[model samples]
Target: MCEDEKSLLEKAKNGDVFAYESLIEGYQKKVFNLALRMVGNREDASELAQEVFIRVYKSLKGFKEQSQFSTWIYKITTNVCLDELRKRKNRNITSLDEEIKLEDSEIKRQIEDDKPTPEMIVEKNELKKVVSDAIKLLSDEHRTVIVMRDIQGFSYEEIARIINCPEGTVKSRLNRARLALKEILKGKAELLSYEFVK
Candidate 1:
């Protein structure tokens, strides 16, 4: 953490609400994104992100600074989302076909091409939906690893820390997750093409 963030963390630990808000400002979007990917719903993801901050604030003093604060926050995020998923599972609520609402900005970020023909745009959107549906079909462990490493661009070390696992475990889990995702996407080979399969 940088000096400013270190100072804010200290103040937040001491019960300064503004400092806590400032400390979490940079992470809000990332937390929301992670939660969204995990839960596949915007409203639930927003609530989960709030829960993550609440947990972080309550556990602020216990944080020993052993890992990057961002990693710690992500850990909290994944835990909160997973807990919600478990609850949903127990209630027999599944959101596999629910459309994940991404804002225009997020859509642009996912597809960075500045210029594209209408056909290309339609194809990209179809591929995006197909891939997202495939990801949702993965088991929780597989989905989490896929979201963290592939979608969110977290390094293996960061993912290992976030998931509280050995680095080798993280790598193996990610490999398996990718294979599982590839298998899921295979059914939609016409839409995804060989590029995604590889």
Candidate 2:
């Protein structure tokens, strides 16, 4: 976290609403992208983003100053995403695998704003969706490890703090997560229409 964010977090922890908004404003996209990646749905990600902020609001009072604000928020977001996943697992797993259908007209609708060819834009969106789906297949521990290390770019020590695990466990899980994702991607290359660079 930056010095400005650290200062804002201090105020937010003391029940300052404006400071809380400032804190959320600083990390909103990260929290949303993390949630979106975890759940693989725009609608679900939006709902999870709102819930994540509410969780942060409620938990601010109990937060210790030991961890970075990003680490702390990530811990909360990962846990909430995992919780949502568990709840969905008991209900229906297929919800996570549902395909996104963007109409051809939707692509043409963007022609005025987008300078890139329609095919390139569609490919970009598809790749993002593939990543999201690949993430959903990981075990909770592996999933959070990848999300923090690969997606969010946290140091292993930071991930250990966020996950409340030893550094060794963080490293082991991250390695396994990478391998699993690699295998899944290998199997999914046909669907993605291009193999990811090794």
Candidate 3:
């Protein structure tokens, strides 16, 4: 943790709601982005982000200072996202890809402007479709691991804590997840496929 975050976390831990809000302001986008990508649903991600914060706020009193505050919050968010996915499975709520589209005009505008060329935009859309479809094919466990590691850039150890698994287990699951993803989206890769892992 950075010195600034350490100070902010200390204040938040002391029941300072302003400090907590400040911390949220700093990390909100990242948390939301991770949840959005993992769950592939904007509304679900937004709701889950709220739930993650509520969990953080309610559980703040019990927070031990042993780990990075970010790590703890990530663990909370991960469980929340995975829990939502599990509930979807239980309800047979698959095929909700329309829920994942950028419904917010502002975000879509940003996304569009960020794409420098029409070709890039088309490629991105195509890639997004492929990835989204492939993600839907993954079991929740493999999907979450890939989201945390590949998309969200969490360290394997951080993911281990978030998912309550051993680091070796995280690595193994990630390996299998990569293989499965490559297999599912085999023809999409330009230069390689499953061998990209090696």
Model 3 worst lDDT window (10 residues): 103-112
**Count of clashes, each model:** 0, 0, 0
lDDT of 3: 0.73
Q: 44-123, model 1: which lDDT tens digit per residue?
A: 99999999999999999999886789999999999998999889877878633332223210111122224343355358
lDDT of 3 at 130: 60
User: lDDT values of the candidates?
Assistant: 0.80, 0.73, 0.73
Candidate 1 clashes: the total is 0
lDDT of 2 by residue, 1-198 (tens): 678877887898888999889878968998898888778788998899889899888888787776666777888888888899889878986444433323210100111222333255357676775566667766666778888789888899988887899999888778777877766555554544444542
Identify the leading candidate in terms of lDDT: 1
Which stretch of 10 consecutive residues in model 1 shows the poorest summed lDDT?
A: 103-112
The TM-scores, one per candidate, come to 0.82, 0.73, 0.75
C-alpha-based local distance difference test score of model 1: 0.80
TM-score of 3: 0.75
Can you list the residue pairs that collide in candidate 1? none
Report the error of model 3 at residue 170, Å: 1.1
Task: Please list the Cα RMSD from the true structure of every candidate, rounded to 1 decimal place.
Answer: 8.5, 9.2, 9.0
